[model samples]
Target: MTDTDSLVADLRFAEPDNPYLRDPGTSFHPVDELDPETAREQAAVLRDAVREHDARYYTDADPLVSDAVYDTLFERLQTLEETFDLDREGSPTRRVGGETLDELDTVAHVTRMLSIQQSVDADEVREFDDRVHREVGDVSYVCEPKFDGLSVEVVYVDGVYTRAATRGDGDEGEDVTEQVRTIRSIPERLAGDPPGFLAVRGEVYVPRPAFREHNRERVERGEEPFANPRNLAAGTLRQLDVSAVADRPLDCYFYDVLGWRATAPATAEPFSEVEDDDSRPDTQRAETAALDRFGLRTVDRSEHVGEIDGALDYRDRLLDDREELDYEIDGVVIKVDDRAAREELGATSRAIRWAFAYKFPARREVTRVTDVVVQVGRTGRLTPVALLDPVDVGGVTVARASLHNPEQIAELGVGVGDRVRVKRAGDVIPQVTEVVDDGDDGHFEFPDTCPVCDSPAERDGPVAFCTGGLSCDAQVARTIQHYASRGGLDIEGLGEERVEQLREAGLLDNLPDLYRLPERRGALAGLGGWGETSADNLIAEVRASREPPLPEFLAGLGIHEVGEATARNLAREFGDFETFRSATVDELVAVDDVGETVARTIREFLDNPDNAAVIDELLGFVDPESVETDDDGDALAGLTFVFTGSLSEPRRVASDLVERHGGSATGSVSGNTDYLVAGENPGQSKRDDADSEDVPVVDEDGFADVLAERGVDWPPAE
Candidate 1:
């Protein structure tokens, strides 16, 4: 941990003591009292800048700050190593843990998590349970609640449920066992005989009346709500559509069991050791009474506590009579009741010598910008958006946000009487990065076209598009609300709240009248959580979405610059719907990575004659079925490939497995990629874009040994 103490703990910092910090001490931290040469150069520049910004915020989903400024520079490098004694044993305070994800398959944890120390109030959880009863004196407690959600771990084996993970820097994670086998209180088998390889660890929420009925059905289907309820319970448990996270009602609670070898011949190391006759767990008295005798669900022991004035009188009775909590605690955890003075007061790589979290005070909002509209997405970009005035911050409400392009509306020059500065951004949605004020009557007027189809608004690089594809009715009602979305075409009772009650009851004006709504099936089974078998199961899910898939019927025909991976690479290389409606824009720029702005937006959406009479009356009610293969013969036909890592399918099924042989699927590795496949962990900037485009690599078992050396029969390996 040297090299001139990682260049003086990369010039350490940590300033905010408090001031409505909208990003103060901008992720503060650095007061741990230092001096062994500034705690060995601030633990070698905070363990090499928090492991390269935790690998650019969680394995490169790219973040650099905004987890409220990486938890205020991880609590000012935990208060400059707790008031400058700078405890550097290679500190991020001795790393919690990570590094497994080769598309997830590493498990190793025969017990060693130990990291939960916190403090925000109740006199720092009573000076951390009075320095753990002044280091092991008279103890016996356990309190738990701190669940804002998403810290799983699970395991089980003999008692059944098999795997769940994601406490990342606590040990390895991201192996969401096929999205925790679609959650339903996670049981896959254990009713009793379990304890064999049983790991346990808890949390995975959403509740708060299912996060305000899933953000009021994503703002009545104009789609995009979630910046709370722990990012829709961490994007519905990382969905890559495990049946869309088994129709979302996800919930789990557990608490803390960790590798239960049939309850240690029932404890003798005394609840695992701190001393006062240190050796107890033979009967379970708390880690929420040994994870509530193995069945889970434990954060409600009347907000558990043993006193810090009864956990600040149960956190001021949850901000006075439970701040309408149906879910979402954001504070009150308080632990350490002698498991031998919490193991003679151990831990500090990230948290816990005896527990403390009391925390709850920075969700922010100051709203004002009354008008800044622009919108238009579906790849016709144009964002800008704003419109605020509402407010509420953490308890949710936020009127409207997203100044994401127009270079964040001229780098946050957010006009219309400014005084803006919202948050939520990567917490879920709301954005407006900043525009506090510029006087000169806080400017505005940015338009340059398409106020719903006045056409021409093009930019790109800090985005702005709107060449008004197929006549924009607000980008065709946000692409038919992402084509009756729930991730495209889930159709059921059509949303955006019944497409604005069928556009103010003039009875919906598009997407072939949302499939002949049988004249609104008794007003969608009399709406309001709809009934009568949910309106005959929403006209049998809109007649099973007139049998979709031709890449979800060309992503529900919102076409113009088509996306959904370019409508599944134009439905796996034009094999139907009249060869992609008689291809042209130079025959989709002669296919391999079609471009010229997606072949002039697939030749202006097949030269719209009212979208080719709604694609020939929706191909006379659906059936463009052509599962590739005539990709005209073999050796990867007209070659051109790309893909990078973690692909056992998805990157639009590896561009329909390179247009199923007659290759053509590009998204980066350039110089006309004729093969760059590479798999598993790949990304040193996509192996330097396939070594400066000499592209060759391969793997998914070397594209099945180049499809059995071209005799092509590769489907048997799954």
Candidate 2:
């Protein structure tokens, strides 16, 4: 058996196969290269960094790096620890999750998150069967398309659902009892007597049909899409308010039975999809059928086969069948069949040692680069994008994919009009995987400077950026646009259109200058497009925005390596704006998510006299507001959310909600978060991360519940 250290080393050698681990393959720092001590330190450092990024990226849809970069960092961390003696309990190399969150009200499981016996391929399955036959003397195994979704524990008290929780650490989880109640398939009121108190464990998922429609809307609207149905399903179940779950098209597949009533507990249920083609049910199989008849969405039991080879053949057939099936499946999940043998095989601290996920390769397709565009990000970085001729790759369109940077363009050797092989590298974001041709009139001429500001761009590593921060109008336009953004000041009258108008009219220069308009109300009150009333309203909004919470205030500043979500995390830990600014590198890094790089960037930004002056000016405008905002936010705030597809949020609510609450609303979920305020059908990305993190969902009513939870203990002081 591979000890934890040997396994980590194997992981180091293994190419991280997930799309989220996307990065340049050429620069991979093999884990074998690092010495033992260095591997350990690297593991700890990267573990903290990756966890923070995952929380921000998956839970909040707020990422500081592209998916490729995250993958790159994660894989390298794995490599270092695996090749050396550097494995930690909390090693980022494991790619599992953080320590069980404390915020979730504790729940003790009736049964432990049991281990799964695994088979990655047909050969492994045969080996598994060989061993099972030797031990249990002619036993079987169950195989099923492990629906790519979340593992759920369902508790029914006398045929009525008592509780539902995510498979957090396979122990206790955030009690999402309220949210699960809304899942129509879950049946809050079960059929027949559900064995007094039945605790059923199953995989809850969003159907592929729903997932496709959801992502279509997301794509059209410019919101992030869920990677797969499994992610969407997992995210959906964790909604704080069950009503939010009602709108979603969700379903479940019962696999293992974690617990049952005192009377039923003694009875064993056959493993789902057991490998017994010639099944005249042994008593356990009969019980499994009976349980399924009672309305737990159990897998199709008849598909099980006796021979491991036959099962692999069945597994392959199942993968093909997945194309026709309504639900999503990443791979075939094979588990031990005999009930007694499964118990003997046992489990592990993290995943089930018995079961394994044999993920399919990311779907790839070829497409031509019809055109190229340089998109200027909020931070003024010019990223090259490929405008494709619209081809489908990995069940999604491959048009207008990000090249990431100029170097990416050169590496692919692609230009304005060239043929390229585009792929959804990790079944996630679409990128030009490689260039198949140099089909062009000439070689690609990479931009030497910023396209918009014409600033001399410098490549510091793999990224290129416009260095003119405050001086360039393009930079200022983006900055002010970001400042007045919903995640920033949340000024009602200052959306991008209004920001453009102000910038064009020379009414606003930067974030801090907006405060000046209130003083110059007379001038603002008589602008060409605005009447006295409208101008005064704008002035008032700007004045009102001045009294921001520390989080919102920090986010509004538009610092590099910071977003509203990250800002809120920093503020909560630091307490106030001044203290955050004064913190040392060590102190900043001490925050759960903040790393040395983030800490240094923050310190460097604060040290600038110009930057400090902006903070000082913001301080003078008014007292700091709340640390965590609430339901009584801008009209769009505190809405219980599950974005099936997309919406207009564009990741701005973080800023907008902050101004309203005298605190901040962030992107991801944690015990401390107020709500999963969402729009449209948000991608499963946030929901999945939230489910794992154990945050509650809320609709308008739930929002009210949270507000009342916060300080609405008494009616308005009227």
Candidate 3:
């Protein structure tokens, strides 16, 4: 049998000690009946069993047990770990993911992650091949499907998973260690002998089937579906809540090694010192094989080709079969097979000389525009949508496409009865690319008034907005949903579906109408899918939010350019709602991080008579507390501090302390920064940035000394 066949055969059977291999009649002890010793032993056994199962399912594609059975075993293990307090550092239970991060930290890559040169023209690809042949005569090439997803650098130390980061700017990336740990396909520990240190570059993506199902569920729940799998994957990896990422169906395929170091048992010589060692992979094909042996999942469709023509044929076949695959691929990557050949070819500053990405033509279809409609978002921005004669583009039947705004509409000259060529931008959002044929109707004229509320529409640069504020029915539904979102008051049971139901029933018309729901509890309980218990719980949650934090209240208003961070800055600067509302444009611009545009937007929102009336009505039911201030002094004023690595306290706490002392703390180092407070094992990227920006680098103790010199106590009294 071939090596691959043998591996597959072995994966079909379970080890004798595996919990699932036990006799069907044999009953397991319940959690309540197990002693500490028994629970500990079972936990270890379960961890091993689950790891083996994950290998079979994710890597080998041969699962011995059904998903239901696997879930049962996983839940039992989690229960044991939590009940016995036997959780270890690398427990499989970590996959469930409950950890939350204040922000994504910045880290330096062990080596630069370069991009591949790409072109949609076949001639460009042939030129690349000619150059490669000139440098390294007659070298074979390895071809792989170029995944349309986010690129990440995953690192391992001593055969155990260490950390992961995004491929931001090639040299620096945002740390996503906890988020990446939740992907089951990525093994926490290497299967065989691994190098002392390894950093592999890979793409993380969501399967197309899962993406469709996720979008379907979102639409059913009255939530906006994500544009495409790539956007979803990127957003998921950057999420601060690990649990949210864990709930999503994310997978990864490792492609290239960015860094490697040999250790004892593998080799005594380090990777940098070993030039011709057989222990290290000599070719791209062998490197993929080595990654597979180390329990890393590599692309299955990769192949070795003798010449560029064969690579082109492979790309053609992949493009034809793209729709059949579970993941999205926009092009095919061709790389020099031999490592020596690649070194001889060398590389440019931005991309490698021995590799090229031949892209496919974008999927597009020509269809007629039947009508045009306007959509008003929660923030009052107006969007123009084109109703199209249904056409199939990239396997999706798109009946509507976004015209974006009036400027785009005028540029395309698109109107009713016009033939337009539609393309799914990024293989997700359908948009009109150009007018194929002008119709009898010359061009579509945008409305001068809001279609839903008849409010005067005004243009802000390229985009337009409704002056209706909360009066528009379309805007009110979305506004209420945003008001109760996690970034807002965080009231439970105020999801999109619930808000729609309340609106359709004429029970809610404005922001203050939500607080008035308590008086209409009897009517709410009578609605479909809601009983007395659910209604009362929702009412209680609403009542509980009558008095919210100033920042949250500000953010919940759906004000333009006012997100969580900006709201916090505004709250800290003004202290109270009355002061913040009355602040002038100049005063708002004086706040940290608030630019002229954002300051003007905030002022415009508060100065509007309609918005003021809503605020006055809301104030009757809601009382936002004044933000606490440091009355002692602003000794650290006019200074900006950036932090990296593990400090004496959490980074957010340190940042809050800085803000409390009238100083600004940012996430990245720049020329505006005054000091970089680097704790133990601080990121090398921040240090490099500090050097480049000529900013001072100080340890935690030095920071404390600086604070002490300002008459502020370090490690503030508990």
Candidate 4:
């Protein structure tokens, strides 16, 4: 028996149900009852587990356990540590996050980046509002979505972008200016000019659509997808290869100008040393508005309310529409609109006193586990999935949830017909949190063999992996499907089922064979599902895909750790397939976003004798295009403008004018926005956001004047 089998053999259970999950009311009782030495030992085990989970969740973007399970381990460790006086430095409880990677230089923040106090209960929020009123009179509040992402401080001097750092340890952070600059939303130069020195703090996150595309590509490549967008964004930022940063679809939403100093040119010393007569925004709303006028993006939706009831109502509304947003937000942040009120309320040693993060309750539901089945992932990891009876979780119907692995299965002691609790983990993935009751049905027995390929699935740590690689029919079908999927080569009429049929017919063995489909056209036409027309169409698509631009070609290969963004960056860097194919590991790693792991994977795949021969053969049949510049090289190439409401022409026409002249047209008002072209009945919220940020708004005629100044014709020559 393997170590995994031995571990499973030792699972302990209570008389009726899984004892592994302790009672919520008294979860730490087992440790509390143990002797001091044993308690310390248990504490150690919990600590290591927490660290491992953190690494998986934060760094690897693949969490081995559910949030509920990790929470239990964390809470238990905290209890044991306090009981035995083991709460010291380096304890998991003391740190905000896992260790910062040494890929970037460390820099001390001008001012500490503090976290706000959080409350899940509405009553607590009310209490906080009451306390704020008692301390500093009745005040209006600015409430916005609390973005789920990495926080960074962006610095500018004399209106020029200079420094960007991560929120590491609050007081100090990693200097990721090189990586941060690659984010399109973050302006390289602040628009409205003229701040002697300023620092704006905001969240950097990957939007949902981009995150979904990234994971889809990962699954196609037979790799584990990231657990959440927040983790993926954070991991991407920390990558050593600056080129790697280019491929990731990242966005920044500025929330606060941490500090700013306005000074004359003659007396231009550091803001910290020479601050004397500069005036700053008097309110949080004003500051965020200033950021918007300065051409920086802010939260898509925010509210300014006069009463506590209004704030609470906004929070409720956000909870209802949370999943609808393009990015993740755990809750809404309510802050005193008046800067004076915030200062008067003061702060605790750790958190701001005037601001509160009204977090939503964890989205959970109760359901019955009908059965347990092993899912063979792209990487061949055998994950046990709880086949749940159809149940509503949050707003969606969940029929299945991940069990993580055998250890989690044993820990839950969940059997078929068992009642279990499930949570919409991060409001995205459904996960089994606990077994509520073990029914008369017996416990689930993990299969010893791979369900897909019938190979011996060997247990290693928490994952049971199938020994089969590309030989597995399921794996091959998935890979080929990935190669033809929308985000890949985008071959029409070739879905997973069709790919499976092709693979089974012995016409397709590897990705390279995809180009040779025309050779098997007669045979394909004679197959059960195919006719001459369909065969010809398939061959046409296969032929058309042979000349995919560099990025699409790289993405189609489904290389490990390489997604759409990474592929795009790589394509741009190498210019041609031959150059990328001949690049060394060091050369690859030196590219912006490519880290050591990704570099090694790329090198190994390309350097392999078999893989190289296949690549060489494919190159003969394909032509890879060079990366083209995103801008049209017009006068306004770097400027971003938003056209609102109705214009003389359609919104698309107006936007096209901007894009044609080398400017970007966006939907929302932000600090980094260069202009807002307003027409009849423009969105009040956009106008309000523009006004707050001091963003300049123009009528159609005024817009024409601005465009004319840029040497663009009012209407292109017809």
Best by TM-score: 3
Candidate 2: worst-modelled 10 consecutive residues by lDDT: 270-279
lDDT of each: 0.60, 0.60, 0.82, 0.73
Error of 1 at 587 (Å): 29
TM-score of each: 0.33, 0.41, 0.54, 0.43
Candidate 4 is scored at a TM of 0.43
lDDT of 1 by residue, 180-204 (tens): 6555445444433345445677788
Q: What's the lDDT for residue 318 in model 2?
A: 71
Among these predictions, the greatest lDDT belongs to 3
Which is better, 3 or 4, measured by lDDT? Answer: 3
lDDT of 1: 0.60
List all candidate RMSDs to the true structure.
24.4, 28.8, 20.8, 32.0
Question: How are the candidates ranked when ordered by TM-score, highest leading?
Answer: 3, 4, 2, 1
Candidate 2 displacement at residue 62 in angstroms:
40
Tens-place lDDT per residue, model 2, 134-163, is 766765556667666787787765565566
